[model samples]
Target: MPELNVMSEPSVRPPMTTGTGKPLSVTALRKTYGGVTAVDEVSMEIAAGEFVTFLGSSGSGKTTTLMMIAGFCEPDSGSIVVGGRDVTRLAPQKRGLGFVFQQYLLFPHMSVWENVAFPLQLRGVPKAELRRRVGETLEMAGLSAMSRRRPRELSGGQQQRVALCRALVYRPPVILMDEPLGALDKKLRDQLQTEIKRIQRELGLTVIYVTHDQEEALVLSDRIAVMRDGRIDQFDTPQELFERPRTPFVADFLGAANFLPGRVEEQTADHTLVRLDSGGLLKARPQPAPPPPPQAASRSASQAARVRAAVQPGRLALCPPEHGFCTGTVEAVTYVGTLVRATVRPLGGAPGDLVRLELPAGHAPALGERVGVTAAPANVSVFPDVVPDTESGG
Candidate 1:
């Protein structure tokens, strides 16, 4: 991770009248199209200068919530409050928010400087002041040399930087980005992610970023709101979301997790003991809080009963069969750059029921080898098992 240039001294630049950044509050935002509900009562509070990502797969209502926040799409009900002012009914242009779309949205007819200056021009900023602001933004984004170039003349990444510069030129209190880096390749995306973070920090900008990419959300966000069916499933820091997901979907979506079918044998204030269906006891820290119930009745009784224990691939370690919590046979081994991943089939599990284990490259077992997998109780997360609905693709 690149170090953020957090300054202790006051900036020499003129103070923004619109406010550096302000807390954003979304209160029960709901939207429906025809008979299908797109967003269902989503609410979240974003602090000033904080970077929050709305993360979810397609049709999950992430984009709808962002659109409502941007004032582009009107909600059927609820309100959007920015800096303590209600802006739900305000026009997009009057909301005083910056926007960066996936397409870059740069005018082909305009030069890089002109693209960045468009917002200032719309606000009727004086020519001299506009020129100075645009120049400074271009320089900060390392695009001063390309100021004379058109959108077509720049690379995809450069075009994105130009788009970002345009959004920041006005210094809006909140900047909404809708998968702005989605068009670029992996290498370029990674580079731009770092650049975006650096710029956000330097400007103390409150950013509400939207992306379906889990890794991108994890990398860029100080906190993440994991959306599902138009509601937030979990809103938390990346580490918390990964280590203490409230639901199976969040756990499975954030990363690879081995879900062992189990029932809560004993629940206590600190720990919960579970009995695995295949055999053996496992222990996990009890969840202190349960997530908000889903808007629709979608969970099955069987799934609700089995959500007692879940462990990530990295948390499970190989142990002597006699001392292991669950014994299995190594069915396959894959070497992925820094770590080796093994597929293990539990001794009594149904055929095709396998667990993934991530181990040091040198410590991986050979195929057809017998292995016992056990995890420290501290690393395990106990929650109600949420079975995915095949038809709904939960």
Candidate 2:
């Protein structure tokens, strides 16, 4: 871990009222390690009760940003406003926020009840209130019957529930979870995802979750912030990000996409016409235009920008060579459980250039077969091909 050259110990406590969730705001947050920028001008305005996930691969600055919000890291310049109170300089413990980490972080010798009651005990709550809160939280997590078991004796899922109960015992207005289910197996993780969502909505807690799993982000987030390099590539509802990404990185990150490099031949409010570099004309849905370049640039120069049409594997259809938008030869076929995925090598494309298609099971296209691959224009998203290095990738 890189060192954080930050120091602060504010004595003020956060507002920890329990009821409706509270809003969170991050503005112009930036962090650096030596000369490399880890988080660049990251900003968000999260609504009360909204579950937002920071989705990115490792070292993309998602964790760094979350740490800054939790007061575990210090930002070089930024403001963290939680529930309308600025807590940028506040200490972690003083922030009075809930956190559930990947590791259980439970006390080995303590029973579930003792573990859940720990935070309230530190706050010096009355014994009656502490017991009431702990019991209520345990019940909410469906762990009431096992409240007497020690962490070591419980199953992994149960242990995680204890950790979650511990975080919620204090009824913090906001919760920060860092891949809390990363340690579990797929079945357990899927089961717990539902449990976590149920508890969150039942309590109306504002949640900031961090995860690298695209499926997890899609299943859990009300809105997702897809991070790349050191900046947010896109932040929107899961449906919007998946169906209407404005950048190639966003399209590829949220889900696999085949980017057909091209130049914009014509553009309208609803769609764009692209002449693919491989000698095929294609239509794609128009994305929000990128911000214009400097004032000194010429209009004709702006019109010459390169673009790409991003189509998902599922959207690509295999057809007879003469019927497709472009002709290709089937180079590889993969037997995914419910689908047959085939890779097509375009006739005029480079040796490494390949387009993949997902066909229904039993509709396999034989390897080395001649075919045409095409996708509907409306199903394709078009974006500016030139992306800044900071938003290019993790």
Candidate 3:
């Protein structure tokens, strides 16, 4: 991985008002279309200079929420206050925010300098100021040497840098990015993730990023809002979200996990004992927390009894069939990088349900081998099951 020396470059924009990222607050934001709610009372507080990401699958309201924040998609009811000013009903341009789309959206006919200068020109900036600001932004993005090159003349990454310069040139208080790196390849994506973080830090720019890539969100965000079915399941630091997901969807969405279906036999302050349907028991640390309203407070006694233990594949170990938490027949094994991925079917679970684990390189069980999948109590997260989607909206 490169060191991302972009920050080390001489600062282009002044570290005053231009560098001071304005705080943002979204309250009770709701947007719906055709009686189908897209963003359901979505709200969050983003600090100045914070790098926040809206992470979720397609149709999960992340994009719609972002559009509302950008003033492109107006919320039906709610308020958006940036830097203490209400911009909920303002036009996109009037909100004074930067936006970078999945596509570079650069003017093919305009050179890098002109593209970066376009925003300034529209704001009626003087020629000298526009030229100086464009030059500084291009140099900051490491594109000064290519200022004369058109978008088609540059590589994808370079074009992206140009696009970034265009967004940053005006020094907007907040930069809202919707899968800006989605079009790039993995290698380049990795490189640009670091570069973007570096630039954001150097200028103290507040960034509101959106992406379906879990790894990308984990890599670039200081805080991630994990959305599902039009609402945020959890908003937390990556480590907290991964280590202690509030729901099975958050756990499964953020990482590879094995859900051992079971009913809660006992709940204690320190641990919850689960009786697996596959004829085994699991001890997960602490009790599962019910989700908040919308999906919260709706589970019946029987539905509440139906719970699952969520464990990351990396947290599990394979042992002798009689020695660990549960016994299963090895159904599949595959090599992934330095780790071996093994899938096992519990003795009596439903068909198509399997427990997966990441064994150390060369340590996976052979196919058809009976093995026990074990996890420490601290490694497991228990959540009320969502398989039977009921009125609770699992």
What local distance difference test score does each model get?
Answer: 0.83, 0.83, 0.84
Backbone clashes counted, model 2: 1
Candidate 3 lDDT over 350-379, as tens digits, reads 897788888898797889999988889988
TM-score of 2: 0.87
Residue range 1-394, candidate 2, lDDT tens digits: 2211111112333333345578999999999999999999999999999999999988899999999999999999989999989999999998888999999999887778788878887798977666566666777788877877779899999999899988887878789999999999999999999998888887788999999999999999899999987788889999999988867777887778888877777878877888887878787776564444344155576455666678888888987888776788898899988999898999997777789888998899888999988778778987666543433545
Better of 2 and 3 by lDDT: 3
Instruction: Write down the worst ten-residue block by lDDT for model 2.
Output: 1-10
Tens-place lDDT digits, model 1, residues 1-394 = 2211211222354633333777899999999999988899898999999999998888889888999999889999999999999999999989999999999889888888788888888798877677767777887798988988889999999999999999999889899999999989999999999999988888889999999898999999999998887778899999999988877778878886788877777778887788887787888876553332353246664445555467899888998877777888999999998899999898887676788999998898989988888998888886655554322323
Alpha-carbon TM-score of each model against the true structure: 0.89, 0.87, 0.87
lDDT score at residue 83, model 3, on the 0-100 scale: 93
lDDT (C-alpha) at residue 243 in model 1:
85
Task: Give stretches of model 2 more than 4 Å off.
Answer: 1-19, 287-305, 387-393
- Clashing pairs for predicted structure model 2, backbone only: 229-393
Cα-lDDT of candidate 2: 0.83
